[model samples]
Target chain A: MLILECPCCGVSGEETEFHAGGEAHLKRHSVGSTDDQFEEYLFMRENPHGVHFERWRHNNGCGKWFHAARCTTTLEVFGTYCAQTYEPPKEIKDAISARRPGWSWRNFS
Target chain B: MFEAVSALQGASFNAGIAEVRELGLRGMITLRGDLTDKKLIKAVKGIAGRIPEPRTVALKDDDGAAWMSPDELLLMVPHADVLSTIETLNASLKGTHFLAANVSDARAVFEVFGPHAREVMAKLAPVDFSPDAFKMGMFRRSRLAQVPAAFWMNEEDAFTVVCFRSVAEYMFDLLSIAAQAGSEVDAL
Candidate 1:
């Protein structure tokens, strides 16, 4: 029942219209990386109960992939942005921090 | 002489509330590039009347353009004019990174006409079909039931839907079922 808006085409649709792409902004470990780093890269994932960032595709709409910042507890969406960036934009981070103080996710706080 | 044939061979259905008719063959071009590029805009304007704004359509008679994405546009023209339109686009946008392909055969089009046309569309797609929300010239790309589809309102009582040709029968069935008699949701 989650209603998400595609930032690319500015169309809002139901969750059924989109495909969830799991976690977002994962760093890849290249060929020369250590076993621990590669294992962490492949296996480790953040399962935060509060604020989280994830990837979603507007599969039925514009067919563009975008990032969404939301809360796992209340299903409150902080914002959605284009997926072309390496990290969540500062405005989205600030918006999340404003609502949930002392919140930190990986390298972004 | 090669005879062109549509996927559904001109299917039509009357469900009391609306009339669903296959639009036969239509010329469609998938153009991808920078929408703001001057040459690209001019080339597309020549064919579709004008470049559509995001989530909108620019229509002039049988020719129109629907905004598919930030970098893509779906141009509609007469079936016989697809090849020539592509050639014109290629010549207009030479040396620029762009793509224009004939997708006329890849899609099936249907028109739903009646006073309750929006009701039929509202039953399947998860879109705001309220008169205030989905006005004329507004194009939407979304799923109709379980398959991918796109639609736009040509008039208050008419809607045009497009889906892959492989699912033309399915789309026709979906529309006909949604338009069945005594199944109106009069909410929007």
Candidate 2:
């Protein structure tokens, strides 16, 4: 049972109380974009073994969506932050980098 | 004029450890806005006596308010006062970006009263029902088995649960099963 804390409501609950909304920080490819870009936007996902960022909804609680940083292998959550950001917060990125040195995701290291 | 009816028409169950009864026709209003705004707080205070803290409730008699989220509060009043309460809130918060809607008929309420009432709640929700953790005034919105529900302690050995009217029977049955005789966890 993976436990996640919703930053919006500050409630820590099991995965059953929340809904996983796939990867986090995806740039949309709207009209006039190339078909490949659109397909990549819709289908491409990062399934990293460690230090992954994902979107989650506090489905049963606050009903607000937020971002979570955790390890896919160990399920060690680095942190959770508000969902209205384009990238993970600096503290979360620093926390991930402290544990996994020389690590990089998307643009942040 | 039209007649109003409650979801369950006052269904009740007794299972030795606890008694579950459908609380008929409660007035509920879903108010979404800046909880910290002076005008909003004053408007809510006029109805509930005070604004509730995070994940808590501020109640007085049949009227009170429960914090539902960062930007939402559930206002409780007498069934006959729902419309008037909303009108007052709207008039008070005219310039604010807020929403106050009457949700009385859209929901169902139940009461669990007994020595083991916390146990019955613990069985269904993924919450800490221990006395030290869940005290009076602390409200929680969580799942009751397969449905979304919110509950809070109203007395030392009693809890009030609220859920959508569509699942009133399901919630009642779930509570009944959880409070069934000889099915006690005896932990909390």
Candidate 3:
């Protein structure tokens, strides 16, 4: 039973209470964009073994969707933050880096 | 017969282990807005007598105000007063970026009252219903045996569970089975 603490509702519960959305922090492709860009945006996902970011909804709790930084291999969740932001918050990045010394996610190092 | 009838219609089971009854014709108003906004809070307070905190419920007589999500609140008022409540809310927060809808008939509410109420709930949901963790006024939207339901405890051994009107029968069937003979074990 994987547990996630919801940033919006402040309730921590098992995976049954949440819905997982694979791979976070991807650039959205829109109309008039290159075919390759559009295809990548629609189908591409980074299932990295080490540090990774994700989108999750506290579906059974707050009904809010948020982002989480976790290790794909170890399943070690560093932290969760607001989904409204374009990128992971600095604190979440710092938390990931503290555990994974050389790890980086998407645009944030 | 053009009269509206309750989903349960006085049908109950489990030999009084846990009694179930429908709260018929409840007036539900779905309010969506920024809870932190003073105007919104004041407007909600005007109807519910208090602003509910996150995952918390405030009860004033038969009226219940619950925080459904970060930006959503559910107000349960008397069936007769629903229209007036909506009008008052619209007048109160006239220019706010909010959505208010009357959802009275959209769902059905079942009240579970008995000593084994929490135990029966624990059998269906993945949440912990122990006194220390899940206590009074804590409202949560969770699945009860794959049916999306929301519940809140107003008394120590009593709770109110709501689900879509379409699935009320399925929900009752599941609960009835769970409350049947030999279901009351010491632990799950």
Q: Each prediction's DockQ?
A: 0.90, 0.86, 0.71
* Interface RMS deviation of candidate 2: 0.5
Scanning candidate 3 chain B in windows of ten residues, the lowest lDDT window is B8-17
What does candidate 3's lDDT look like per residue over B4-122, in tens digits?
56676645654646766676778899999988988899988877899998888888998878988889999999977989999998888898888889988888888777888888888
Best-matching candidate per TM-score: 1
lDDT (Cα, tens digit) per residue for candidate 1, span B1-188: 98999998888988469999999999999999999999999998898778999999999899999999999999999999999999999999999999999999999999999989999999999998999999998899999999999999998889999999999999999999999888878898
- By DockQ rank, best first, the candidates go 1, 2, 3
Q: For model 2, how does the per-residue alpha-carbon lDDT over B1-188 read when each residue is reduced to its tens digit? A: 99899999999999557999999999999999999999999999999999999999999899999999999999999999999999999999999999999999999999999999999999899998999999998999999999999999999989999999999999999999888888877898
Estimate the lDDT of model 1.
0.93
Q: What fraction of the genuine interface contacts, i.e. the true contacts, does candidate 3 reproduce?
A: 0.75
Compute the lDDT for candidate 2.
0.93
Docking category of candidate 3 = medium
Of the candidates numbered 2 and 3, which has the greater DockQ value?
2
Cα deviation of B52, candidate 2, in Å? 0.7
Segments in model 1 whose C-alpha atoms lie over 4 Å from true places = none
| DockQ of candidate 1, scored on C-alphas against the true complex (2 decimals) | 0.90
